[model samples]
Target: MTPIFPAKAGHSVRILQLCRAIKALGHELTFIHVASKLDTQKPDIASHVAFFGERHFLHLDNGPRQARFAFWLRGKLRRRWRKILRGFGHDHSHYSGLDENWRNPWSHQLRAMDRRFDTVVVEYAFNSRALDAFPASTRKLLDTHDAFADRHRPFVARGFRKGYWVSLTPQDENQGLRRADAVIAIQAQEAEHFREQLAQYEVSERNPEIAVVSHYIGLDQPLPDHGVDHAALYLGTNMLSNQISLRQFLEHVLPRVVSSIPDFRLRLAGSICNWAPDIPNVEKLGFVDDLRAAFARSPLSVNPTIAGTGINIKLLDAMGAGVPTISTVTGVRGLGGEFNNGLLVVADHDHAAFADHIIRLSKDAGLRRSLGLAAFADAQRWNERQLAALDHCLRGDALTDTAPGHVARWRDRTPPPFPTAT
Candidate 1:
């Protein structure tokens, strides 16, 4: 169950891919979407049908009318106060008043269903309370996209404003984890953190087992040997972290590259184009329908992200498309460093080095092809590893053999060291 409908965002893509993976394993899936109070857009029924099949989906207007009214009123007041504070030269960007105790009123409906489910998976820890509706015989799983306990501290430390999302105290987060039979974390680091939190709190007798399951992307066929155009690609949404990093790249890095290679262009796609500044040689192709064709057109991609949690899905997508990419250390977090031949990692805010790498990669076609091949190969192995781990979790088996650092031992295959770009 999820509050978010599948869309173009990373989290949404994870949801879509996960359902597809589950179905591939020959398990019947019933998708249930609990309406989010913040979203007003109607659910895309067609997309849901395409994934879960006809009549296998449920949309619940779960919250009570009184609670909804209170939430709406609070939102209005918060917006008004923000506007007023902005006028006073105060920054209220980090303040997000989220209610962690919000529960679904329609959970009782789950009890009335004629069929009994063997396993019930809830998307976020905040919604793990829904597991209460399922019988004790049903195995409960919580797919935590990111850790919520003190989630805002990282953004604040990096000088970025916090966005709207649930930020729970460790104690509250522990309560949610205790409800699940197994907790699925998006990355290894987060899995360790969850284990630590649960150990520290000692909430319940049911010590939920934690497992690491990264994002999954279908590998794209290798690009043809005709060679790519002399342009780079950047795809992202208008999330605050993207906004900060992209703006910094534009201000600090783009100019250096333009000076070095005057005709070189940077292609921007997706909702991120909405906030990106107008600049020379920066082409804004907003909301491109064909992402594969877009990646095919460019020889290289850039993930200049400096802050955020979880695996970077866009980075994985670029690797899946067999495109060489340059990313910051934070952008490549939780991914296997040994298999990063197609990726160039830079320190955060190191604009000069970032620009230099772009220039060098643009001038070297043979190097680009070498990295792209490595990327494609790594993507295949990574997908297999993630699928295997997910299969184990779904089967209620202990992941002792497939633990974080031990994943490289899968199939007894050793990963080669990343090829240097010099």
Candidate 2:
């Protein structure tokens, strides 16, 4: 169950992929979406689910009324309260109960369903409170897309004041994680983090089991004939990390590339275009209907992300489409450090060097073809791994803690030449 409206956010994409994976394992699947107040019932939602073939989709009229009301009320308090706190040069984080709306109606809905399924999979940790609604007979699984605490750490370290209403406490996060029967971690780093956290909570018996399921493009490989299209593409939802990355690219990298290539075109696609800055040589294509065709039109995908959590769906999608990707080391975090594939990694803050690599890839079709083919091959392998991992989780097998070895493998790889020696 996901606490979101239908959109192409990375988490939303994961929910859809998990649904398909569940069905592929020959299990009956039902998707219960907790509609946000901003989300009206989307007729296209049913059509979208139909694309996955057969699955039952249930959209609650809207999220729990009380929680939404509280969310609104607390939002007002945080806005006013923070100003007074800032006057003293102090930061006091308030935890709002409003954020987790799965208390009454959502819980009731699950109880009404009456443990009909073998397991209940909750998409985000914020929504884990809903796990309490399921019967003892039902296996509760939590998909920790990213460790919420780790996600907030970067923001807090820079003294960036978080929106208080949605602020999460370490205890609050651990409570939800500890309650789960099992956890599906998006990356190996997070899988290890979850294990260490579980030990801190000393959760025994019902201790949350951990499984690492990295993101993957479906089994379909890209056709080699699509050929390089001479443009750089960026795909993202309207999240803060994406906004910051896009802004950085525009400010630091795009100008340099434009000076050299003259007609260099950068296409920013998805809901992210809504907030991305206006800049020269960049076309903002908001919420594209055909992402594959978008990739076909732009052979080079750029991920300039400096801070974000979980496996980047855009990275996987571009590689899956056999488009060569150039990104900062932070952009490629959680993904294994394998530069032999079609991925180019640059240092976090190198603007000129990043531009040079962009120029190199843009000009060399053969290099693009080689890297793209390698990426496609890597994606195919990941598809199999994701499916097998999902199958093990569903079959109730004990998941080995793969994080230590996974992290070791990544650390063991000789660091790729940042801004490849051009």
The TM-score values for the models, in the order shown, are 0.87, 0.84
Q: Write the per-residue lDDT of candidate 1 for residues 53-105, one digit (tens) a residue.
A: 77788766646789677767777787788678756756443344333334446
lDDT per residue (tens digit) for residues 215-299 in model 2:
6464455646545555789999877777777888899899899889888899989888888777678898888766777877788
Query: Model 2 reaches what TM-score against the true structure?
Result: 0.84
Backbone clashes counted, model 2? 0
- Each candidate: RMSD: 5.2, 6.6
Q: By TM-score, who's the top model here?
A: 1
Q: Can you give the lDDT of residue 31 in candidate 1?
A: 91
The whole-model lDDT of each prediction reads 0.76, 0.70
TM-score of 1: 0.87
**Best-fitting candidate, measured by lDDT?**
1
Regions more than 4 Å wrong, model 1? 1-6, 38-41, 63-103, 157-161, 202-204, 403-422
Error of 1 at 291 (Å): 1.2
